[model samples]
Target: MSKAKKSEFRPNDYVVYPAHGVGQIVSIEKQEVAGFELELFVISFEKDKMTLRVPTNRATEIGMRGLSSPDVVSQAMKTLKGKAKVKRAMWSRRAQEYEQKINSGDLIAIAEVVRDLHRSDDQREQSYSERQLYEAALERLTREMAAVAGGDEITAAKQLDEVLLSRAA
Candidate 1:
């Protein structure tokens, strides 16, 4: 690191990267690239088993953010319980939109994807693509919920499923 506490983020901070889900700032490191010293935030995604090095200067610009507040999380849960909004667009278009929402790293938008794509026990079966997208959104949402509310992702996922199930019935 160029200096201690050089950026808004610090070691051990859980942050959300737009393309990825929740990750922790493992450390700030300085690496030499093309004769220039670059200070980077080393973010570790435990669920994905991946590590990404983001330049501290561009972290905010790249949509790296702290966890959503409790109010925001509550809103996401409420969204999950709301009616599914399936647009009239073709499957390809809808899939693209859902993919964007999952990658955008906005909690509510991600929740919307999960809600819209969810299927109850009696609902029609989903195509492979639809199932993939639905799982992606649920994974992201659960991870964030776990990070914010203090529990494992499995518990958070179960809670979210209950919310969706009640609405579906």
Candidate 2:
């Protein structure tokens, strides 16, 4: 791999880790391993209370990126407003796709998962796994939305819920 681009991330910058949602860069450290010097970015996932160390050289390769632009977030919100498109496929197959979308770290894809999985007050209830995936997708979307919107997670979540609820109505 060509040497990773110079670290564009700094301490306190919010970044998205494809599999983990949003995290804050806590620090950059240099370590010596196997006679090679390596630089790593230490990131903290507040909601999960988990810390991750990613090699600075591999950050881009791993899909680590900055928060979405406001335009992207707006597009994601619009996605939530679109009609749900549940496939005729088996639930297990759909669930797997939803999981992949949530972990892809793409705002619009996560929005699609939220759109498809959301159940209205008058609609039939979701199965246990459906509800789990729905919550997971929602949480991931909101975390990135919060980072981009300059608000806390709760407010961002409420905004997302409001958008989805309006569509449901």
Candidate 3:
């Protein structure tokens, strides 16, 4: 079956951003930038405010999509529970790749990075940078999940941890 076209966007619609966490579509507006007329989506989160502008027609192509279905979020949670891959490669290189994946706004890829970098309660220390990246990935992934699951950020974060712990055991 063909998918229906979106005729309008409402406030509080969950939207996935490339690098940041899932945000609510707070408003839509038209503005002139560089002397050209443009339309933009204003999204807001508890942590930050972001504005996303697409050529209006190219929004879908840029991966600016609505929140995933519950089933998709469940699959991402399952992915989070899997084994972590620690490549022997250098940290700087791996960090760059992780950043790219997070910005890609692919839920599964973000989950993988979060799972791989996640440290257990008893695990050894993480470098300052590693901790930073881990937090960023986790936040990005969970924000979308929360929006999909119809819950607040704290609940969503806890749910993600539960899935990881269940699989880790």
lDDT of 3 by residue, 56-116 (tens): 4455666777787888887888888788988899999999888888888888888888998
lDDT of 3: 0.77
Best model number under TM-score: 2
Note the residue pairs that clash in candidate 3.
Answer: none
TM-score of 2: 0.95
Candidate 3 lDDT at 132 equals: 85
lDDT ranking from best candidate downward: 2, 1, 3
Cα error, residue 152 of model 1, in Å, equals: 1.1
Residue-level lDDT tens digits of model 1 in 50-100: 999999888888888889999999999999988899999999999999999
Off by over 4 Å in 2: 1-4
Q: Rank the candidates by TM-score, best first.
A: 2, 1, 3
The CA-based lDDT of model 2 is what? 0.92
**Comparing candidate 1 with candidate 3, which one achieves the higher TM-score?**
1
TM-score of 1: 0.95
Counting clashing residue pairs in each candidate, in order, gives 0, 0, 0
- Candidates' TM-scores? 0.95, 0.95, 0.85
lDDT computed for candidate 1: 0.92
